[model samples]
Structure formats: structure tokens, C-alpha cells
Target: MATFSSVGVGTGGLDSAALIKKMVDLEREPLAKLETQKAIVTTKISAFGQMKSLVSALSDAASKLTSVTGWNAVSTNSSDSKYVSATAVGGTLPTTFSVAVQSLAKAQSTASAALMPLGAAVGAGTVRLEVGRWSGTPESFTPGAGKAPVDIEVSASDKLSDIASKINGSGAGVTASILSDASGERLLLRSKVTGEEAGFRLSVMEGGDTDIGSAANTDASGLSRLVNGSTVTQSAADAKATVNGIAVSSGTNSFANTVSGVTFTAVQVTASPVEISVAKDTSAVSSNIDAFVSAYNAINQLINEATKFDTTTGKGALLQGDSTTIALQSALRSAVQSVTTGSSVFQRLADVGITQQRGGDLAVDKTKLAKAMNDNMEELKNMFRSTEGGSAEGIAVKIKATTTSLLSGDGFFKSKDNSLQLALKRNEADRVRGEARVDAFEKRLNARYSALDTQMSKLTALNAYVAQQVTTWNKSSG
Candidate 1:
């Protein structure tokens, strides 16, 4: 851009500002071309960046198949899932066994006599809760180790509802609520866990004057009335089950450690033995293969779009005719199609039902792959896992190594990006220099035009003096 404030005003009637602007624009032509070139290069760099990300993602997916031990997957099934459900927690040999659930675990529950109104005041005292196992018909008391009793205080004006709230808020190992019927309202207590050892006992002592009850902490009045008159609605119980005719018991319905690497949960007592089976997880292996295919397809798609050329439009993609991009596309295709060079039970990806499609993407054959994973498991593992020597490495190992190097420092992508960045820097420098030249040109034009204006003014003054002299002579002569 250029501007001239006092150009062509004296000597000529020309649009000097417009002329200066045109000249400056001509001078800036090179800078505009430079900007266009920089934009193209920057676009190329961004495309390469996306390609690198996809290759790195492919590497991650490949790495999962490089370890042989990681493929030790197993699936478990239960014949009667309604009664018992089984799961494989760790690695174990494939086997089948019978489970007979004799009884499910049950929590202990107790209820007070339904004789008090909803708001009827009950005597108050310090009620202590002792948690432990309850056994035998006589029900002798034994304190659980490391469990200190929790004591709660009650006032004379407190109703059964208030006691229930206090019990719930005390953090005791039991839940309390009030149940109402036509007869009256009764307080109900249940153990927090469904096991014999989760049972709790309640006793009351003197809290203050008039709220005191029997000194033995058991009587028919005060807070002790709840425990003394409460009936055991459900006794604490443990789950009982049999595995291969051997009896097994658990405090809860879940039986985790009965079998090595196996856990089963009982929902109901089985009429007969429920069979549980464990086997190699073929579906898991298939999923891993699918992940590998998906990652490879992503890389393939990016390269295809970036390098494609349209014949009808006479236009090419960003990476079209780029030697580096072509080489990358070729290398990835070769890696997938090439056979394993090292000691593998299976030689190539195709040997295990994975094959390249028309556009260089991989596709898995579900039925064939499942059979290979089931019957030829060891061979499939060896094909995907690496051997000690690099000469006989697995396909995954080779792809991992290649992708890792490409993403590393001093790789092709790094060098290309660095070169493009330098070009950008140079572009900016060239723009600065170009602008400076335009400024110098504008200055020169202003100087030349200023001198012409001064010269023209002097000539006009001299002409006026000459005209005045001629007019005086004519008048004198007349």
C-alpha cells in the first residue's frame, strides 16, 4: 500500500495516489506468491502430522499382540445362572465341575412386640449393642474379638421411633426401622450383612433418674422392654454348597475361593447340581485381532485420501506426487502382506484368517479365525508374538519397530516438519524485506514529484512577470 499527500498538484492533474498504489502492488506480487507457497507447505505438514498419529495408534494396537502370556484369557459358564453364576477370576485349566447349592445365606432379624402407639413414650436408658455370631439352640453369648460394644442413651420422653433413629445414626452394625399394622407400631432390627457372625445383641442400662430399668440390663420396662420381648424373626445363617460331593460353606452367598481361579455366587438353592464349565476365551482373541485390523484400516484410509489424484477434476491431493508419502504407503502394505521371517508357527497374517482388502486395508474372516484361535491357538500365538532373535520376529514386533522409528527424532516426518518450519520463517523474512523495498520506492516517488512541483511554481511566476512588462509597454504606446 502507498500514499502521496501532495503529488501532481502543480505540474500535472494526475491521480498520483492511485499511481503510487499500483506501483506498490506490483512490488508486492512476489510476497503474495510467497504467502501462497507457505500455506501449501503448512497444509502438507499438518497432513503428515495426522498420518504420524495414525501410525502411532497402529503401533499401540500391534504391541498388545506381542506378548504371549497376555493371551491367557478364559471364559466361564454356569448351567443354572438363576441359581448360581460362575466367573473366572484368573488363569486356570479348562474344566467342568458340579455345584449343589444347599442353602443361601440369610441375615438375622428381630422384632419388638407391637403394643406401643406410634408416638407413645417409652422409658430410656443406655442401650449397648454387642455384635458376634449366634449358634446352638440355647443361644449362649460369646463376645466377638476386637469388637467393642456401642452404647446409646434414651430419654423418658423418647418414643420407639426416636430410638430407631438414634440406633441408625450410631453407626452400629445393624439397621432399625418402625413397622406399623392395625395392632400398633413395632421396632424392627436386622443385621447389616447376611452371615451368622453379623448378628447383634441389644441390652439397656440406667441413663438417668426415672429412665433406669432392671440393673441386670434386662427387664419388662424401659428400653430393655424391646430386647426382652423381641422375637427372633430370622436366625443368622451362612451359605452352604457342595462341590463334587465335598461340603463348602461361606459367610455370604458368594463363594470365591472354593475353586482355583473360579468364583460363583448363589442366588437360589439348586434342585440338582448345576454344572459350571471353563474354557479358553476365543472371543477375546478375536476382539484383539479386530482391534489390529481397525487400526491398520485407519492408517490406510489417511494415506489413500492424502495421496489420491482426481483425473476428471485435474487436481491432486495434498500429498500427491510426494515421494515420502508414497514410500510410507508402500512400506505399510508390504509389512502386512509379507510373510514372517522368523520362527513362527504361522507364517503370515493370512495364515490366521486376516487378509488385505482392495484398498490395502485388512479384513478378518470370522469363522476361519475362530477355528484357528480354538484349534490352532499355540500356532496363532507364536505367529503374533516375537522370538528372541530379531531375524525371526513376529509381524507385530516388526510393525512396532518400524512405526516407533518413524515417530522418533530424526525420522522422515521430523525432518519434513523441520524443513517446512524453516521455509515458513524464511517466508516471513522475505515478506519483511519486500515491504521495506516498497517503502523505499514510495519515498523515491515522493522526492521526484516534490521537485517537479517546485520547478513548475517558479516557471509560472516568471511567466506572470513577463506578461506584466508587456502590458505596461502596450499602454504607454497607446
Candidate 2:
């Protein structure tokens, strides 16, 4: 039988195939490791991006703290902050200064002359106002030419609330409403149709029209005005309600006469004091700064993870000593160091106890911070909120403008993240491209092994056939 070589013929041929196979097999581990590395890098990049966002939020919050006078976030546990003068706190008293009134634009009591007026007297029935033409006869109601009331049927599933929605949605020339008071809830209907004839007529079909009283129809058991106690009917749009001889407007009335020049709007009729106190919100400003500091710390913690070097693990930080991170750190440090000139407030980080330590880490001076918070509150507020001309308008506005320019799409954070993402992507792509080369190598190796198998099988068959033929020839010659 023909023998096969234990080792392939040439070192550069089958030997190279085995070497390539070994190399390909070895590549699987590193490729997997590279994939893991890519994941880690992606995670770091994403975390940094999140850190950027959080820092931006923190900075914004801080800016708000610095600029806004009364905008503060108090802890739920803090009792110094109070909701004192609001509704529930002083229920019987006029504690709240805020006022919101129902819109009266839809409260139409009169219309121009195009509508048909109801006749002298009527009683119990469903008042279905059918649109029609005017016939001089009081009972002869004819459909108006080129005019029709939209046909709308209110279902049992629909409540009084749904009626308004239905009429408004049906392209109808009317609106439905419910007028609520101490008496009860009354269904009110008005016309969306403008001008004199926009108002529709009402004719009861089921229940008695006892509640259908209007300025136009009062003789039919319905009152033009619901008389109750000393209450009076108002007809004009500009009418004001009086309170102990004080002229209070009906719609969102503001009184600048009270609270030492403080304008307060009357919301409801109450026997309470109409006084609201406005003071310098010092605690609020402090709490806001504290919250901003907390947020900044949270972001700082995340960034620290990426930049930290672990001495115990003997492993480098995920983004350890990254130039971009270093640059950002430096920029932050410099930005914090930059002082606002000609300000009466604590303009520099040192004034607020934020300083760099010997270990290159940030240190806080609690006492200094407290003092700065207390002593230079207004100054700090100005430093944060002061405009280019040192005028205090909106603190958040100025801070947002500055920070947005630093962290926006074309800003430092964006530019750095984008560059890092591209670098990571390129590294991952290169790694994947390198790993794909192994597939071709693996295929070539398999092909070589298959050719070797076929050649060995053919040689064995030829050797067996030759050996059999030789034995037969020897036997015949003997």
C-alpha cells in the first residue's frame, strides 16, 4: 500500500495550512475579547455621554440657583419651607394670590335679530330648537331658507359633559354647556353662529321647560335671572362684582391697592385676609444651590469612574488618561476658576469652598460655602444671573445661554463625544474586519485537508488493486 506522509510535504503548503488553522483557532479568543473590549468602550462612551447630560443638567440647575432669587428645591423633610397662604392651608381665609376664572366668551345671553323669539307662554316638554324661516304667525314655525339646525342625537351613554363635545364636533352652529352653582347643574346651549340670528329657538319635547329660562324667554315659568338672597343679575360684559364697597371685576380682577404695592387677584369670595407676603427668598436660593451641587456630584462620580486608576485591581480605568477626558477636566477646572469681575457677590469657586486639593481632586470647604451662601446670597445671585451689563433679569436665561454654547451639538461635549464615538467605531470596525479574515483562512484550511483526504483514499485503492493483480499473475505463472 502507498504510504501517506505523516507531515505535509512543504512547510509553506499544508504546514502553512495547519499553522493558519492554529492561528485562526487562536484568533477566536482574541476576537471574542475584542468584542468584549468594544462593548466596554461603547459602555464607557455611552456613560460619558450620560455624564455629559447629567453635568449639563447640574450646571443648569446650578445656574438657576445662582440667578433665580426664589427658585429653590427644598427637601420633603425640611419644615422651614411652607405653602402657607395657599388654598388648603388657610381654607376660610384668602390665603392664595393666584386666580383662575372660567372663560365667559361662550356665555351668550343675547343675539342679534335674525333668530326667532319664543312666543308668550309654554310648559313641560323637550325643547328641540328647529331651524326654520319666520312666518308672521306666532305658532307657524317654518324651516328657514338655506338654513338648518344640525341633527344631533344625544345618546344614553353620553352625559351632560359629552353633549358639549358632540355639538362642537358635529359642525353644528351651536355649543352646549352646564352652568353649575350652589343651586344645581343646569344645561345651557348657545349658538356658534355669529351675528343677530345666530341664537336658536327652544321647544321642549319631554320635560317641562321649567329650567330653560333665558333673557328672551322668562314668561314660560323660566326666570330671566335666578333670584337668590342679595344676589343681583349682571347684563353688561364689563360689570364688576362688589365686595364691601370694593369694586371687584367679574373676570380675573387684580387689586394693586393691597399688600403694600403687591398686586393680588381675588379668586373666590372668602372672609379671609387678602394679604400675601413677599420677602427675599434666602433659604430657597441656598437649597437650590445645594440641589445643584448634589446633581453635579452625581455626574462627577460617574466621570471619576472612567478617569480613575485602580491601584488594587492593577487594571487601568476604562477611559484612563484619555486626552479628551483630560481636556474636559482641565476645561471644567479652568471654567470654575474663571472669576466674575466687578461683582459684589462671591464670584470665584474658592469663595464657595470649591477648590482643587493636593491630590488633584476637588475639595469643599463646608464652612466657607455656608458663609458665602449666607453673606453673599444676593451677590452670588447676581454673579449667576447678571447680564453682560450686570443687570438682573433672568438668571437661568444667562446660564443656559452660556452652558448651551458649551454643551450643545456644536459644543465641547458634543464635539468630544462625537470624536470618541468615531474612534471607538473605527476600532471596532477594524477589529471586525481583521476577524473576518480568519473565515477565509479557515475555508482554505478545510479545502486543503479535504484534498489531502481524497488523495490518500485514491492511493490506498490503487495500491490494493495492484497488490491483488500481482498475486494473481504469480499464481498463474506457477
Candidate 3:
């Protein structure tokens, strides 16, 4: 549990502890060198990990430029968003349309005539509910054709609250609630969905004596009284709109597929038409190019730093002179400089204002890029995402392929990482063996010193006793 700094006390007048330590230190010196080697390998591994991350980032940025949809994005502008707003997706052609909002869709609702107190009993009955649509001025309610009606049974002792609960739990397309006001208690019902097709009608069949459920005793009437025409509150209506003078109707405010790849949402009624236009989203393509340039520069910087030599310090970087790193840098530069042979006027990255500098980093000219995008958009697109393949392949595709190979399982980087890890393991094993040998040598030295100290102590005591005898004999003879 504890370790001693020295082995012996030197009681026999010899510094045996210091001698033992010197021997042990000499024997353990090789372990220290092995530790240094492990540290160097670990640093190399860390550097390689950083290299992989930078390359992966560049690959992700390049992938965005390989697909047509990535650059075919569109943007929408609505002159008046108060009444309607629109959005367009990729492949939506550039065009303009006029949108007019007439009316918003509404849900049907109804409230019963004033009944007795909240707890007052209503006669037992079977309430049947049907969902359908009603149209035309002074609307007429008709049960939906071919649709089954939901039937709910109530007991004679059921109170007004119990009736509402039963109707709510009947799985009908209507919701029921009890509303109490100065007039007393009433049942309020509303359709679960908006629009005319979601409208519903309720009819009741009383259970017992007609006296307790008669229309005359409206206060204690059966559920049938709730369906009277006078109780009708709000009527359902569909949303009406117009696009370029063409009438359009929807069951809800949100309309889709009415305009190709465009979704229109009606907010409120508008007196005048609002102009909606879809245009090519050139800004998005510019942003993608910017990202690619940024990522490419980052990888370039990392590779340069990892392989640079410092003349002042007379030392190179951690990965300096490494063949794998050198090869990767060369391949990336070659991929970028390679010409893309396509039908487009722009055949290379420089054609689009992306030029490589002397240090192997890319720079962008915003003005040139914008002009190219405007004048030769189709040709520019083909230069970056052509499907011809081979030597005519786009720069992005080429770079992506190169990075993918370098980071693969059996790739250069992976092989180097495997070798470094193996070296570290071997160094650790050597350290362990060296430490074991040092410990065994120290134990042997301690044991030998302990035996020598005992023998010298015995001899010193015996010499003192013989000297005392000789001195006494000399004194007596004098």
C-alpha cells in the first residue's frame, strides 16, 4: 500500500540505499523513452482526426451542388399578405397571379331553448344525430344521404348535464356542452369540423308518458325540443376565393395544389386582389456557392498547417513528410483544377468566378458570379451539375468522389490511423514489461543490501570485544 524512497538506513556505515536507487533508475530509463514515443503517436492520431473532419465538411458542401433541385429553388412575393399568403417550392415556374378572398369557411353551431335548472331531470329518449350539408338562401337541413346516424339512449332520471355527457360520448361528429345564463340552462352543440359538409341535425324519440316530455312542458321537455328550428345558431359555409378571375372553393382556409407547387392560405376577406408572384431563387444558389467556398478553404488551411515546415524552429508539423497527407492534398488540388467538359459556356470553377489562389485556397468574385448567374443560368447550372459524367463531370462531383475515397475504410487515412494505434499499443506493452523488470531488480538489490548490513554489524561488534580484551591485558602487565 506504501512505497519507500530508499531501501536501507546505512547503519553499517555504507550508503546502500543510494546505491540501490541508482541501479533501479538506470534499469527503468528505457520505460521513459517508450512513454515519449507513445505521446508522439497519440499526437499524430489527433491530427489525423482533425484532417478527417475538415474533409468531411468539404464533402457535405460539395454534395449540395450536385443536384438540380438544390439550385432550382423558388421564392414567392405577395403584394398584400393581410388576406392571403403564398409559398412556392422547387420547380415552380416564375409567374404572377391575382388572388381574391371573398369569404372564410365557418362551422355550424346551435344552442337549445332555456330548460330547467342544471340538475333538472329530462325524460328518457333516443337521440339520433346525422351529418350533412345545407346550401341556398334560407337554408334547408337535409340528413346526409347514405350516412348512418349516431343514436344515443338516455334514462328517465338523467339530468340536463347527463344528457350532454351522453351525446358527447356517442361518437357522433358533434360536441355538446351545457351553457347557463340569466334565462337558465341550455345545451350548446357545434360541429367538430368546419364547412357545410360537416353540418349535423339531431332528432329525439321520447321513452315514457308523453306528459313529462310534451312540447307544452318545454321546461322539462325531452331532447326533441333541442332540435327546433328556432334553436339554429350559426350556419356552415365553404371558403370562396378567386385566382386570376377563376372561382375556387375549399372546405378550409388552407388551399394547396390549386396552383402548381404553390400553397395559398386565405387570412381574411380582401376588397382588391393581391398579386402573388413566383420567381427563381437565385439568392439560395449563391448561398450554396458561398458555403462550398468556405468549406473548401477550411480544408485547404488544415492541410497546409498539418504539412508545413517551420524554418526558424528547424522542425516540421506533426504530419509533415507524411505520404498519405501529401497525396490527399495533391488529389484535392487536381480535382478542383480539372476542366469540366460540358455544353455550358462555363466549363470550370473559374468560369463562375471561383478562382484558386497561389496558396491553394479558393476565392470568389461576387460581381462576376452574379453576372454569370443572370446571363447564363442554364449553362452555369450544367457546369456545376452536368449528368454527362466522365471528364465532363462537375467539379463538385469530382471533389466529393475524391474525399469519399480518402475517408473510406481501407483508405489512406484509415490505414495510417490503424498503424499509429498499433504502435501505441506496442509501446504500452514495452513500458509494462520494462516496469516489471525494474521492480524485480529493485527487490533483489534490497534483499542483498539487507543481508550485507546484518553481516557487517556482527563483525564490528566482534572486533570491539577483542580490542577491549587486548587493552585490559596491556594495563595489567604494566
Number of the top candidate by TM-score?
3
Candidate 1: lDDT of 398?
A: 77
Writing each residue's lDDT as its tens digit, candidate 1 over 1-478 gives 3457764646467666677778778977898898898899889888988988899888888877775545777899998899999988536789899999999999989998775556798775787788898877888656678988898888889888899999999988889999999988788999889877888887777555343234454566666678677898998889999998899998899998999889989989999999999988877777777888999999899999998999999999888888888898888887777567554457888877898889888988888788888777877876777565465677777787778878889887798789889988998898889889878988887777667677876877888899999999999999
Where model 3 places Cα greater than 4 Å from the true spot, the runs are 1-10, 13-15, 112-116, 119-132, 136-178, 183-193, 200-232, 409-417
Better of 1 and 3 by TM-score: 3
Error of 3 at 307 (Å): 2.4
Q: Give the candidate number with the greatest lDDT.
A: 3
On residues 337-411, what C-alpha lDDT tens digit does candidate 2 reach at each position?
Answer: 556643565566566776756434456766887787677755665555556544433333444555666677798
> How many residue pairs collide in each prediction?
1, 19, 0
TM-score of 2: 0.57
Model 2 lDDT-worst window of ten? 225-234
* lDDT (CA) per prediction: 0.82, 0.50, 0.83
lDDT of 1: 0.82
Query: What are the models' TM-scores?
Result: 0.76, 0.57, 0.83
